[model samples]
Target chain A: MPTREINGQSIEFDNEGFMTDRTAWNRDIAAVLAKEEGIETLTDRHFDVIDFMRKEVEEKGTAPSIRRLNKLNVVPTKELYQLFPGGPAKKAAKIAGLKKPEGCI
Target chain B: MKKLLILGAGTAGTIMVNKLAPVLDQSEWQITIVDHHETHYYQPGFLFIPFGIYTKKDVIKPKRDFFPTGVEVIFSGIDIIEPEKNQVKLTDGKVLSYDYLVIATGSQIKPEETEGLVGDGWRKNIFDFYTIDGACALAHFLKYWEGGRMVLNVVEMPIKCPVAPLEFEYLAEWWLTEQGLRDKVEIEFVTPLPGAFTKPKASQLFGDFLDKKNIKLTPEFSTGRVDAANNKIISWDEQDIAYDLLVTVPTNMGDDAIARSGLGDELNFIPTDKETLQSKAHENIFVIGDATDLPSSKAGSVAHFQADILYENLLSAMEGRPLRAQFDGHANCYIESGFGKGILIDFNYDTEPLPGKFPLPGIGPFSLLEETKMNHYGKMMFRWMYWNLLLKGAELPIESQMMMAGKRV
Candidate 1:
């Protein structure tokens, strides 16, 4: 288990690597992702995507793959890349505090 | 007989008056609207003002003109809303009683909310296009101005027409090119949003448009303070963005009367039921447009959609019937990408914007998530619709509810 401080909030990753607290996860990670994406704040749409990512991981045991994410909605790859520059898996894993799945790297 | 008193005759109030006036018989109900300002400026038209696409005359009109003749228009500021007594006290000490009140007082731009935004360079170099005065002043400044570093900045989010700053930058590029000063001006769009817009798909499309126009993009720049003396915007991280001319959309707050009425949140926006638009504080009052703390775009299209539902529900409330209408946060907006091209996006509470044909599926004259000349014209044509159709509360061909028909899902 490890923890990181992002955007003045503390986020903890479990040994199994899911966010210890999903609610706190959003506030903690939205700021970091927003900064990384070069946005001053997160919009409702941003929260929609972030919440979607969190739920997908909680249900599926892993962060949703890029293909799955693209097919689920119309979030353009370019904008998604800008937000999750390390790619969806890495970024989602980072935000969700989940362990990086086997194939993402 | 119940009385309905609406505060502020802005876009939201105007629509409410139009929607309720025709349906409710005057003998059975009394509707009164109070507003301090005499004029109603076509707010969306402000976007085109600085670019010379629209003139001051094109946007300005007497507020009394749009209101239906039967409805009482009181040109006075509200001092307080004594909800416990179900009475509104005006600045002139006129006490008006209401059985049910609708607060449609829209947001206001407070540039001073951000430190130094209204400092030395305010109108001289820093400008705001949110207000008629600001837009007119900016238009005058841009007329003889030789081009240099022009920065269009959004101080915070939840602004009226979130796409406006981007629209300004897009039009500025086109205007500069047309004026043969494109090379001289370095146009930059600085926003708090991650990309050109709040939505992901539209942001990608607009981000490319920014690239094509050669406009610099600065995202996530949370402004801590405006250093007017140095002509720079200092972000919380201490990132300094230098600008020769600063077009800033200051922090937009709900009408001051909301604070006086004790009917607002920290931002002076009334906390409302997301689906019903009913004021959370009082059962007899409802809120709409920019007045509500709904997680929806504060655009005219949203108001139009909400009006349909509010019209139904308000009648239900009057008749002691169950509220049947539910608003799904439907909002559609046209993003002017400049070069006579625009993009349209439609979405609701449950859906994010998807790429597909709009209004008519598969044979769209207007495309979604894609730019086209037709959408640009559609955006322009909205002005006529606003005055003739929307404000009058006339039924538009488009459905009030967000349709999944033309969209992919």
Candidate 2:
């Protein structure tokens, strides 16, 4: 297992990239993303998409497609890009601590 | 030349312009849109701005920027609509006649309707998240303020997004906890509805979440007045709930022009054939989005769905044919439950939100009526889709008509 500290919180990632502790992943990764975006705080509404992405990864064993993610989420695609400049699969998997699904790049 | 005149360039009207302008033949039909404001806002994003998740720049853009060049964008307030005359009068003393009319004039927030609400505390101790100014002002206020008893109050129902207030409370809990003030901030949710949500099954789940968050619920509260000086809200039954700060969803009404045109109900919302999207008063006139007195939610998703039906029906009406398309009152909302979890709900006029997977029944990448991290990400990513595709009237792979797919009966 590899570990990274974000915002003073220790986050442990397994060999496959899934976070050992999902709760810590959200808190630490969300903190990093929020800071990167220059957002002062991460609201529940902000987490609405982050959590949705994690669940998609957990169920499909891969990051969900952006189109599929947006269909279920009802958010606009451009905003999704802003939240995940690396695109949905990359950004969502990174935040969820899951490996980037094959063929996403 | 046939003229397609649209009233109010709000969410629905802007979408209608984007949807029809490119498709309609410019040689045969000219499209003209009327709106008073120069800017178009992502109204849903307004919910997040108050909580500091979105800034002013995130939610607004120039109206003309989104409209196609061929579509004539008229920035003027509407004075009246004479259905018999087939014309719309502007406050600028101009009259525009139309071969066909589309009323996308959206709703407004009337905080003044409630006694003492717009009194001394408005934008001070009391705030609204429905408007950009209100959201920004509330953001500033929430910054200096430490932990205290906070109340997220809804004056009435059928406000834009029903889940927004609950999202605020949930996000507030997360924010306060981060600030090390969660235990000190006694958050409460006050609504006219009996449950945490409009649907029962989802309500039960959300109600339990409220309990878990230690956020008190005051349901079925018909707010009578706001005692700003005293920091209290009084229900019609004289139940008083004191608070240090009041975040309110004001009484939502249809555009004032609807009332002025004698085309609206007491709330200024136009009565329309729920299925056909045709104005009940006139067959030639159509209404959609928050302007209508429909039982459905006043959400962007509803407007997106209605645009599909209305687009078909308009062409039918233009050809002197019967409208074959029907709206199912379908609406879906993502409820953010903080801590990187969210819930998705899909329902129509008759159905309540039920638990299940969405779009793909057995193979759901997303769950309904259950909180999951995937649902949360889905909710956040939507803003991008709104800007690029949905507002552009670009065809999404998802069907406009509500499907039984991915949902439990």
Candidate 3:
């Protein structure tokens, strides 16, 4: 339950630094997160994935995986990697205030 | 008679059919199990196929071998499921309606989902061990062939038997060392997860093992496409890892029938209530094994654990009682670490794998989160138990819910 002054608002994150209070996230915080993820400027394409992820999480109670995003033609997976860089699914999920994708050990 | 239809005569479905058939008053309940395939492959044994440790005899068996008497077995392709009508139509035009349905058509590898995966080099240079054919093919390819860059890539998260890929790598490391070809071969494990495993403690341990074994680790690699012609797998971000022989666990998805039924997530995994084991969309329908989109390890142990709760809950549902049996998402797996040693991990949805003795607490015949020869024997001996005791629905000594009795936090 670590709180950070993100976007001039105190926001909480888990030990992994994924946002805890998902409701505390906003467009401004997304920019900060995007910058932290090495995307200095948030573009429309970035918002597209972030928004789609947020909506999917809202509806399905979980973040849609990269495969699902590609399967549904939400975004071309290569573009998703280009947009988020490094780990697109995990990084985009972090920016979108969603938990790291759930998987069994 | 009220009809109970069980889809997929795999481990979970078969277990349910056996457990319920004798208990549910045969006169009142007409139990029927449907599956397209006649053969029931011991899926865990597939991991040994590539190393010449096991062959067709160990993995393959007639599906009917496990079915209890009086349960109708239909061997035919599943058409679309009419959930609204409470019926499933076979490809042969017969429709079977049921009061309660259990969906357990397990997950399969979708190599076609990735670009260049199924093309020219497939079963040649690129291979998968998740299936009997793939394992056998890899076994053939490995025979008399000198190794080079051997890359094992898990294309995505939530693949069936999450530990198998690591085990494959470890076994390769051991087997190659045995053959004295270890010096010439370079081993690399590429995965979507940040490390060797989902849990932090176990991941660290497995990561250390990989390091000690001289197998390289490539973490958070979201596989985009297989560059078979070039002998490399390119991640979505275009991070490419070149391999002479690529053993890829291409996207594991639920049955295509789930997609046709429109009762599944994008990956065709049924949206199931994790605790109740009931379909989120249809109350009369329950999902088990790799078919459910529960955040549990897609392994036999999970299905075995789920079978107990599903049994109690299905009976409760039949009697119009609230589903009191909650599935704790218990998954117990023995990771075959090779060199005749393996690791045992027991965990649930809430708890991560911890260092402890299992089942018997301090006096456990099996240790948790540590590599031991006893654990290896436990893994090997499971094959017999799977066929004899488990699929027969005999009560196992282990509890379905994960316990903190012996675990060190």
Please name the candidate that would achieve the greatest DockQ relative to the true structure.
3
The full ranking of all candidates by lDDT, starting with the best, is 3, 2, 1
Q: What is the C-alpha RMSD, rounded to one decimal, of candidate 3?
A: 1.4
| Candidates 1 and 3 compared by lDDT, better number | 3
Mind sharing the TM-score for model 1? 0.82
**Which pairs in model 3 have colliding backbones?**
none
Which number leads on TM-score? Answer: 3
* Native interface contacts kept by each candidate, as a fraction: 0.00, 0.00, 0.86
Candidate 1 DockQ, CA atoms: 0.04
- The residue-by-residue lDDT of candidate 2 on A43-95, one tens digit each, is 56546667777786677554554545655664445456555443344555565
Q: Each prediction's Cα lDDT score?
A: 0.81, 0.81, 0.90
Candidate 1 residue B172 C-alpha distance from true site, Å: 0.8
Task: Return the DockQ of model 2.
Answer: 0.01
- Give the Å shift of residue A70 in candidate 3: 2.1
